[model samples]
Target: MNITIYDVAREAGVSMATVSRVVNGNPNVKPVTRKKVLEVIDRLGYRPNAVARGLASKKTTTVGVIIPDISNIFYAELARGIEDIATMYKYNIILSNSDQNAEKEIHLIHTMLGKQVDGLVFMGGQISQEHIEEFEHSSVPVVLASAIEPTGKIPSVNIDYRQAAADAVAMLTDAGHTDIAFVASPLKDTINQHVLSGYYEALEAAGIEKKDELVIEGDYTYDSGIEAWSRLQELSSPPTAVFVNNDEMAVGVIHGAQDNGVHIPDELEVISFDSSRLALMVRPQLTSVVQPLYDIGAVAMRLLTKYMNKEKVETPIVVLPHHIEKRGSTK
Candidate 1:
């Protein structure tokens, strides 16, 4: 059902390079050989890959998209933005999931590069030194979307995660809840670490000592939020308010509390980040830090296009704005 250059070459008893040369309109091939290749191509219904056709012009017109998990709503929306912009610029997308694994991330980078994509848009958590080295070595341009590279060496798009976390914690404290808890993502993550730091800063500002029992690490999942709440319920003095890392986990925290017959806001107040659509999908709604997820993805793609097209980019690191979405989740 499909044809390739190799099929044409084998059918015509010609080399692959010869087929390439003929397809590219290179006059170096003999007239007879060119005509034979053309006939084979036509008879085999072999349509040249558009990217291959544009290679002579030094453009593949295709971009690789590396995301942590396409199943995640946050990344899915971001991917949509990237794909939409890429389509506008007439670029095809090649998507792959790294599953937030470092080794897999590196492997995907190499794989995408091997595909000869003109550029890449990457989204992940905790970009490592190895990632930095790989991006530095890439022949094609790479832009990070809603991801962080601690060294600030890579071109990326994100919001001020630390400040956002601090603001959310302050709001919880301002409501007269001294026993505030922090539901965090993977502790190793740079953004999570910053968010945790902001939480501590908020506590310190109010002259509250950090409580080791109040901090729980979650995996940015509803189940984790539920687990965090379960753990909090065991504490001698459970928190009256909590700062959750994401909406999914925040929802879990709420349900976790309700499952145990604990009333929300009346007994526990919850605030979350990423003001993703999930924030609004739950009952009583979620109060969260609104992130420009689509804009981050769209802007990252545009920045990558600029690099791929050899256009000038004044700033490599782009930090989008973030705001808190006040809702029923918090008092």
Candidate 2:
């Protein structure tokens, strides 16, 4: 026979409602009572019938998570935070990867919605009009994690990319490096566009004219960073300092420069975005912009929960704080 909530409640000398509250992670129950109820649950091996509960509550207690690349450390960290928060709320997640492809993303959205997920947490580089239409029409609440919608009509959690990029470039400028280069992500990405804007804004503020050649487009990969450095070397006068879009590419640039006997910081100051573990693994650690990846995911999921539960939300569009982490790569 399957152990039921009644058996656990009776064993713990509490009402079924108390057991239900404890099982559902409700905070209103007293600590001692919660502990006793949990112990009874563990001792009795009481398992809540999720299907029956869903039928009664009209909730599947599941959420959909769409990410760009799960293998990438950046997205992996964000997914970790999202999963943790979801577990606390007793919600299971159906995660899918879109590989930053627009068509695949739309398909995944439709597939997840078909499953009747209570909510969705989406992370991607670009949000086109078609994407916005799908999200707007979604029966369930949708939240963008570390992604942006130009119209600000959709709820999202992210740091200020433009400001963060400008700050990183400003650091290089403050060091008196007039010819600073930028290794950027795909230009089509809205986040990359903001970063590029910041790069130009910082240069303009420093009384330095923008050079089209200095802004090298990258695919946000280590190989692309290496290729970017090679292309920079061919320039008439290469930049003295470089700001890369991500840690992987930043590492590639550093290695490429080192392979050619160029000293870091002293000879070629380098700073990159995304202060992930990869920053410290390199010879000369990367000076990078610290984006709170996990917090962005956690907050996004939490925001989705608020919407799912119909809770009052004062701020739907959340922008987390960002800062530069000084390391050996910069002077």
Candidate maximizing lDDT:
2
Off by over 4 Å in 2: 1-56
- Model 1, 22-115: lDDT tens digits are 8877899999999999999989999888666666657678899999899898888899889999998889999999999999999998998887
RMSD of each: 4.1, 5.0
For every model shown, what is its TM-score relative to the native structure? 0.87, 0.86
Where does the lowest 10-residue lDDT sum fall in candidate 1?
Answer: 50-59
Q: Please, what is the whole-model Cα lDDT of each candidate in the order they appear? A: 0.89, 0.93
For residue 91, what is the lDDT in candidate 2?
A: 91
Estimate the TM-score for candidate 1. Answer: 0.87
Cα shift from native, residue 88, model 2 (Å): 1.2
Highest-TM-score candidate: 1
**Candidate 2 lDDT by residue in tens digits, 205-251:** 99999999999999989999999999998899988999999999999
As for model 2, its CA RMSD to the true structure in angstroms is 5.0
Model 1, residue 105: distance off in Å is 0.6
| Candidate 1 lDDT for residue 246 | 85
Badly placed stretches (over 4 Å) of model 1 are 1-46
